[model samples]
Target: MIYKVIQINFFMKGIDRGLNNSVVVLLIIQI
Candidate 1:
């Protein structure tokens, strides 16, 4: 159970990073 939770946490972090990257890209485009 603990391992599964850790795996999910890492997965979520990756998704968050992707979202942040997209936001950055959008800002660059708007500039």
Candidate 2:
């Protein structure tokens, strides 16, 4: 559970950097 939160945070960082929004959405969906 902790790892999942961390992973989400990591992806959030990517979003903040203006990374691919769709890819992030897909990843979050998978999670």
Candidate 3:
């Protein structure tokens, strides 16, 4: 169970980084 929680947290952080990257790309395109 502890390992599962750690995996989930890692996955979520990966998603957050992806979202942030996409947002930056969009801002660059808009500008």
lDDT scores in order: 0.63, 0.86, 0.64
Q: Order the candidate numbers by TM-score, best to worst.
A: 3, 2, 1
RMSD of model 3 against the true structure: 10.8
C-alpha lDDT (0 to 100) for residue 8 of candidate 1 = 62
Candidates in order, TM-scores: namely 0.54, 0.56, 0.56
**lDDT tens readout by residue for model 1, 1-31:** 8876776676567677775777556544644
Candidate 1, overall lDDT?
0.63
Instruction: Please report how far candidate 2 places residue 23 from its true position, in Å.
Output: 3.3
For residue 11, give model 1's deviation from the true position in Å. Answer: 0.4
Candidate 3 C-alpha error for residue 10, in Å: 0.2
Using TM-score as the measure, name the better of candidate 1 and candidate 2.
2
Consecutive 10-residue window with the lowest summed lDDT within model 3: 22-31
The lDDT leader among the candidates is: 2
For residues 1-31, could you state the per-residue lDDT of candidate 3 as single tens digits? 8876776676567677776777556544644
What is candidate 2's lDDT per residue for 5-31, written digit by digit as tens?
A: 998898888888988879888887978
Candidate 3: residue 5 lDDT (0-100)? 76
Question: Model 2 off-target regions past 4 Å?
Answer: none
Model 1 clash tally, residue pairs = 0
Q: Candidate 3 — what's its lDDT?
A: 0.64
